[model samples]
Target: MSSSQFQLIKEARLKNNCPECYSNDSLELTIKQKLSETQFYKSITNEIVSDINCLNCELQIFPVRWTDDIEQVVNYHKRGLNLKTKSVALKPISWGIITFFTVIIIATILFATGVLVL
Candidate 1:
């Protein structure tokens, strides 16, 4: 079974004020990248997500609550982020399974051609 998770890519402390609490220097921005994992392989996907929170208020600030200043800061931080590339890596078990199947197929072919004897 494959499982999907979001891994933290970046966290930035912004000087923008929280619209709800009206507190300055309490806003934080977080970025995450999607990761998929299974017994056979692990992969990083291109999907990215972000969240904003207020440390002083201990509340999550959704986009709907963002002020213009907060939005601008978030946009700046997002533009500066260095995101990871999407990639897949196979596990040892997956390699072993592939090798086992390849050997079986080769053996079968050889036997059909009368090149392999029992």
Candidate 2:
């Protein structure tokens, strides 16, 4: 994240109106847990880092971009919260919905044609 993005997120967080901000607490906890699970830091070169802090929550976030220039990048990984993607159980629910609608449509067509007999 850049300084601008950090400021924006911080403002949004302070407002406490955005869902993302509301989840920040839980997100931070998860991030801590993830950090404990494995080594999360990596440095390819020194120059490709960027550091930005949230204005509202004052959370320091380090977001890094890989670049050839090592001197230009700061310690970006230190300033931001790291999160992981949670496995969502959507396949079953999605299939169920499709099946449900298919059945409804078929039944409706049958009833409309008098084949379903009420």
Q: How well is each residue in 1-118 modelled by candidate 1, as lDDT tens digits?
A: 9899999989989988788898989988999999999999999999989999899999999999888888888888888888888899999999999999999999999999999999
Question: Clashing residue pairs, candidate 1?
Answer: none
Top-lDDT structure, candidate number: 1
Model 2 error, position 1 (Å): 22
What overall lDDT goes with each candidate model?
Answer: 0.92, 0.34
Q: For model 1, what is the alpha-carbon lDDT of residue 51?
A: 98
Compare the candidates by TM-score and give the number of the best one. 1
lDDT value, residue 58 of candidate 2: 47
Off-target runs (Cα >4 Å) in candidate 2 are 1-90
RMSD of each: 1.7, 16.5
TM-scores, each model vs. reference: 0.87, 0.27
C-alpha lDDT of residue 96 in model 2 = 82
Model 1 ranges off by over 4 Å: none
